[model samples]
Target: MVVEIVQDKEIWDRFIDESPYGLIFHKWEFLKIVEKYSGYTLYPCGVFRGDILIGVFPLYYKRNMAFKAIFSPPPQSGIPYLGFVMSSEYNGLKQDKKEVFLNQVVDEINDYIELASPNYVSISTVSNFIDIRPFKWNNFEVVPNYNYVIHLDEDLDSIWNGFKKNLRKQLSRPEILDLRLVPSEDMSLFYNLAKQRYEEQGLTYPIYSIEYLEDLFRVYPNHLRLYYLYYGDDLLGSITTQEYKRYILWMGNTRIPDNIFGNEYIIWHLIQKAKEEGYLNFEITGANKKNLCQFKTKFNPTLEICYNVCRKDTLGKLAETTYQKFVRKAG
Candidate 1:
């Protein structure tokens, strides 16, 4: 088996397309956009046996005066999870064979990491790719992240029936009927609203530029949808949904305060849209944020836990500890 940097888009994306654990974020174009916007150098590696590609992972190299590290899917990229994408053929492998193949992949990755010699490395894998034992064996600290996903295979009525009473009441409100979901190309509005939300939460604004979002919309128009809720001329809220295998309620921002419940209404509309499109699942991305998790829980979605593997060398670990202390003090 040999591992090398994969420069061919056809080869890289073909494996991702064939893998059930693959995501739209793993696409070559998406990585290119991420690199361009985040100013991170992308290192995409492919593990091959004989002449066949078996596994692929993309790392982003981030450097600053305070730190130098590599991330599978870097911070503030709006990517939920991305790690190794193995070939679908591996899915049919026997348990023992699967373990062997995974170890080989991890060995190759370790080799790459040694050559790069970054201060730290972090990798977050999708929920379906549960075999992270290889990473754990390599001394990486594995942490779990959770997401809320509603299986859409059931009838719409059954799905709606699962919602909490208050959520159902909000969806049935007469005022909700007045709001129209308008699909628009105006990403600047979405960015501004998202920035406002971050500020309201006392957090830093996201690093994504408006140009980057426009590029994403241009590249994957069908996969990315931006909708604004409007009551005639008054804009109430905005949400972005992505259709990549499953429907994801990617990001949302609302001008309406918590008292108004505009977000719940918009999410309900998106859920109905997902059902109409025959999507297998509708995911409300992060189920870890306190208030956000409470809001999503009202929909009665299943909780899916994903894993993030993190590792840092001695000095890197010290630096991380100091950084955390500084952040706590600043907060």
Candidate 2:
């Protein structure tokens, strides 16, 4: 197939929108934001048989600033997630013939990379445990990404029963708190509070900047929102929601202490809001392996495993191995 890059948004959006099995990442809105914010460069190559598009590989180029001066322009950051969205099932290419199309698409991408001579390329959140071919690009590296998910399909009564005693009491005593779940217009408050807590704990806040949140608000106001748990004038907690077809991902959350705001109450209210919006599932950003898993089980949502796909050089791999060995020996 002769591949061509699509420059027109309308055509691309129409094609992906009509697809049966689609992911939010493949949607035009997401690509537009990534393109707008990152602005490295967009190489959206389409595999077409004559006039019809069969597959597309979207990628962006970025300089490796950490290793700057060591290599010119360095390696490109990555495509974010081009491979997962390639199948015809997700992009209106051809559903029944997905395997054949996928293989062809992968080969074409590899060939394209070689021809273009990009220093490095990678994809993220491609779960190695559940994906079809976890690491199709033998040359890249792989990392495991864990995301905490709360199952919501089960009856609420059954879910309520599973919560820890204290959490259950908190939910039962919701009337005790004067907290209101209000749609927040100002994200700066939440960002500053979250940043402050992170600084106090000597940690980096793991999230996009306030500017990106504002951009998302402007772009997808209906599908995404910033909700706050407010006690009169004080903002107790805030959460960012990413609404997709079947699930509402709790992208981020921040809270202050004193228990006056009720952290659990904020979560419960978010759940109620998601239900009201007709979402089937809610995801809590994952923490560690044990406590988070146990905590999320109270919600009774199905466990959805998330993974990170990484690409490491030979020396980097060796360094990782040595670090792991040192930790094990220390233990």
Candidate 3:
């Protein structure tokens, strides 16, 4: 088997769209959207046995000043949370034959990474493929990226049974609550509302700007949607949902009216829309924030961990070791 690094989109489009294994991240259209918005160089590395494309690892190059490597370039997001995406569906389908696929994928990707020559390589949000032992790293950190999902194969009633009792009730409530979910391209309004809510509560605004968001929205089109909540013409809440590959990621939401507006209700509404749009799952994104975790639990979705794998420069390795040694000595 031989691996090839396909930089052209036309070739990748055909492969992803045609592959029986169904690789999502390796799809050319997806890569184009990401590269257009994030400006990350998309490397579509795949393994071919004779004439057939067998396995692929979709990777991007980035750098960070904090982790200077043994060899180097300018810094980037390392493994930007969203970049190292793989097709979970594909991985699941090929699980039994994964060893062969895994070896081919890594061999190709390792070569691709070396050409980029990043001293550090990081990957995250890996799904079931980790069981195949996907990648080996010098240092790694693992943490839960809790996601909420509802089985759409059944009727809404059956799906409701899967949600938390309170959540189901909230979704079914018809108390004439003056809430409205407006779907629109006016993402500026959503950003302003979210920013105000964040500042009012003394929370730092995210690194993303309205322009950046608009750029992202334009690139992904229906793949990512924006919705704002209103109460009798008063903007109450806002949410950004991204339908990446198979998962509908409820990326960010904010309630201007705070607890009085029922943030949970807003989320349930989003999940229902995701269901209506035929999404298989809803990702609540990551965990670590105590308050965030508490809020995520209300939906009653299965919880799973998201890991960060890190590689250190000589200096970073020494510092990390020293820090650990110091903590151990203190203990």
Best by lDDT: 1
Task: State the lDDT of candidate 2 residue by residue for 11-123, as single tens digits.
Answer: 67666655433345556666666556554555666777677876555655544443111111112211222343443444344555655666666566657655644444455
lDDT: which is higher, 1 or 3? 1
- For candidate 2, give the lDDT: 0.57
The weakest ten consecutive residues by lDDT in model 2 span 68-77
Residue 44's lDDT in candidate 2 = 62
Please report how far candidate 2 places residue 274 from its true position, in Å: 2.0
The true-structure Cα RMSD of candidate 3 reads: 6.2
Instruction: Report the candidate with higher TM-score, 2 versus 3.
Output: 2
Clashing residue pairs for model 3: 63-75, 63-76, 64-75, 64-76
Tell me how far the alpha carbon of residue 232 in candidate 3 is from the true structure, in angstroms, after superposition: 1.7
**Candidate 1 lDDT score at position 74:** 78
Each model's TM-score?
0.91, 0.74, 0.73
For every candidate structure, what is the RMSD over all alpha carbons to the true structure, in angstroms? 2.4, 6.1, 6.2
Judging by lDDT, tell me the better candidate of 1 and 2.
Answer: 1
Q: Which residue runs of candidate 1 sit more than 4 Å off their true CA positions? A: 63-67, 257-260, 318-331
Q: Compare the candidates by TM-score and give the number of the best one.
A: 1
Q: If both were scored by TM-score, which would come out higher, candidate 1 or candidate 2?
A: 1
